[model samples]
Target: MKKNLKPTITASFLAIAISAIACQNNSGKTAQTDSLKQDTSKFLTQPLISNIYTADPSAHVFEGKIYIYPSHDIEAGTPENDNGDHFDMRDYRILSMDSVNGKVTDHGVALDIKDIPWAGRQLWAPDAAYKNGTYYLYFPVKDKNDVFRIGVATSKTPAGPFKAEPQPIKGSFSIDPAVFTDDDGTSYMYFGGIWGGQLQRWKDGKYDANGSKTDSQKEDEPALTAKIAKLSNDMLSFAEPVKDVIILDKEGKPLLTKDHDRRFFEGAWMHKYNGKYYFTYSTGDTHFLASAVSDNPYGPFTYQGTFMEPVQGWTTHHSIIEVKGKWYIFYHDTQLSGKTHLRNVKVTELTHNADGTIGLIKPLKK
Candidate 1:
């Protein structure tokens, strides 16, 4: 939603980064039929191993380690004024790496902005869930814009000194926040990246947010739809109403019948298989990450496919990594003739169908 591109900042190296399920065979799957046949080409690779400070990364693995909660463009030279005007929200840091058991070599920065708390500037889009042993980050802030709120920090050490959950997380105006903990642990919180409505934060996990209870609507609820809310065991909020708690697009159609500005799902994430709920997002405009699905995570969703778009000059914000069972879709692009916006980072591989629905793979030449 903020435009002004021309990035190529040297290199700090390292990066990679969803889920949900619905019943969409919209033909984007291209139809193979053998139960939809999908090996996902072993979850391709290129999703930025640091094409530069990565951008909107948010992956998790807890003690298994793959934690990437991004939104620290550092402000670099400080001009370009894409509304973010060089993005100086104090760079809001929190980066780490372990890559399961084999390939991250081991990276650093477990929680930055000197550990956090009102941690000035702005530290957008973050999400992690560990429970009991403690980790829960969940971010988004102008530091103070009368409180553009979307915070909830704590840590028993997924990095260090997190602690900031004394407030923020009650049914209301949000940001690119995502937190999922399903498979039965039941926890959910998906926020609005806003262009106009995608809201939900009934925080059933307590922290109360002034006694949660929200249900929004203004007609245009489809910027491609993907907020994935469901939590209710006290992860802070939302135990219902993805429009009534996970079922897939619930009839909230319109991935863009006409560019009400590229119909983007902003940058939401979630992944749950065998039990269905793969609501991944990020649609072009300046974006590349794209996905849609819903079988319940707090949804009525449906529109499976397009995990990466723009072959060379339009890629977008994204995050998703699922090692061990395989499925990858981390994004960022533009670096050839150099300077369409200087963006970098790229990854691939994501396939499905057997009633699962998702099959993205395009962009490998430049």
Candidate 2:
């Protein structure tokens, strides 16, 4: 009876061991299946940089590579020495990406506000362009007198060690400097914001020939009207009179009269596609990416409406560029830090409709 019981016990133990081994093998197979599923079903990701907060993405295609110039957002004051929101950013970082391998190379600080002799603080929205053989960078910074001024920096390469000009462009007030060159060997600079000012002209380093104030300037006019003009060969100043190219409403009327919906706040980007001028900007409250179009760079621009919506922050500065047959909208959001001022830059593929209008871009989280 004892021997029979011992044999039965051994058989029971072997059955339990076999069951445990089978379960382990099955669990491993299930995990492998899940891993493959996750690898296959992936979504489009954005916010190109995550380790640090970057704002005001200004993208440019240079020599078959995509270079992004963005403002670096860092913790300003310490907890012991609290100083409000502290949006105190002082340097610019240039990031380059050539493929979708999810690898971005940071070229380090391109420009520092402290490096400029005349500038004080707030190294804000910037733009870049390649002309003749030089790469030019345009930035807006407050001067020692506490006035916002536009400045230019030059570099032999896109990702620079840029050498800033001795001083800010004279007579240039307000912020957000957007430089555009047309197909006809023409260049233009668009600028101004707040307090009812949006002005531009040829980048010849000069103002209007008929003088700046054409009509009797009103103190109470809308502050968001964006303007454009031709640029000179050197792109140092204006070459033509500034024209108000503010977006037009659906009814073919200026946006200022009906509402400030499509008016420019800051960050004006110019892109020409298929013989049409694509003028894009950050609208009032810095929440929407609004655009307009016309046959000419300086319009009669019909407001095309908002292409990109607001993110988790207050500001939505951006740039539009075409790279290797792909159009991308480079913008910024606050999803990383949750604070409005600590924003990060992002990019997504932008598409245009058959009618030449831009399609609404859905922001992605990766």
Candidate 3:
């Protein structure tokens, strides 16, 4: 019969037990690792410029600079210049700027899902991070059939209205969300391509049964050969029985014995240069982008190669920023000779070497 706790729920449980005893006695501030080195020789090329918004692009490399956010869908048959028709879009938001030494700036709508409730109103891919002081945006909606899911929002600055996260991340079926924070601090999100599996908020958000994965479920996990997931550390939970599995269709092997595309290895991105771990995915039936390597970072990877070619009308999902020294990939393109099929977002110039390999990018067309 102990039911008398009111006073704002006992002062919210004594301010969360005095902030969990002051974060176990002071240690609460450490999340900007991955300095990014190694790869002493890789130097790709191809994107000196391309459509800044043609649709759904994503890239990260904060603080020192290299942002290239996208997904600012707000179409109306689309048309501001040479081509029109952007398909369906009304207000999703995420358009930061900054490219590098050459200089660039757009900074419009850094983050806006319009207060995600079930995100039933659109709000496609966003992806961002900075932690601690704030600046987090993870998005993806359209729940029902195409069953897309994934929702999160927060903002301390990065030009945003961010601030969501009450639900929307349950068991995950598919979306386009992405977030990765490694180098020990741990924080992951990496979503799936179309309609598949991947869900983890771990650390406290919960769910890392090998860190979420499902392209049919194998026997209940660890079989991949592609489609992806690797979440954990409470960035909302993930990682447990989920193991290796990252082959590319025909050339790398395993289309899962038959019935492909829709799932081959959707988006799946993660970085860590020299020490190892370099995922990067997307393959066949369209959408190119490719790679493989794994000192660990939860992988059995090894594939490697193929940095672009989702064709001129559209390509694969990609993101990777660097700044301060140079490296950019942010992808998504629908050609625009008159607005072909609605996907915009492009950036270019991404390298890699020291012994990692990933060259030839160049894009840059806005």
Question: Which one is best on TM-score?
Answer: 2
- Report the lDDT tens digits of candidate 3 across residue range 250-297: 355443423333234556777777787777767534456777777876
* Top-scoring candidate (lDDT): 2
Per-residue lDDT of 278-321 in model 2, one digit per residue for the tens?
Answer: 88887646478888898887787788888887666665788888
Hey, what RMSD does candidate 3 come out at?
A: 20.7
lDDT of each: 0.49, 0.65, 0.49
Return the TM-score for candidate 1, rounded to 2 decimals.
0.29
Worst 10 residues of 1 by lDDT: 26-35
RMSD of 1: 20.3
The candidate 3 region of ten consecutive residues with least summed lDDT is: 1-10
- Candidates in descending TM-score order: 2, 3, 1
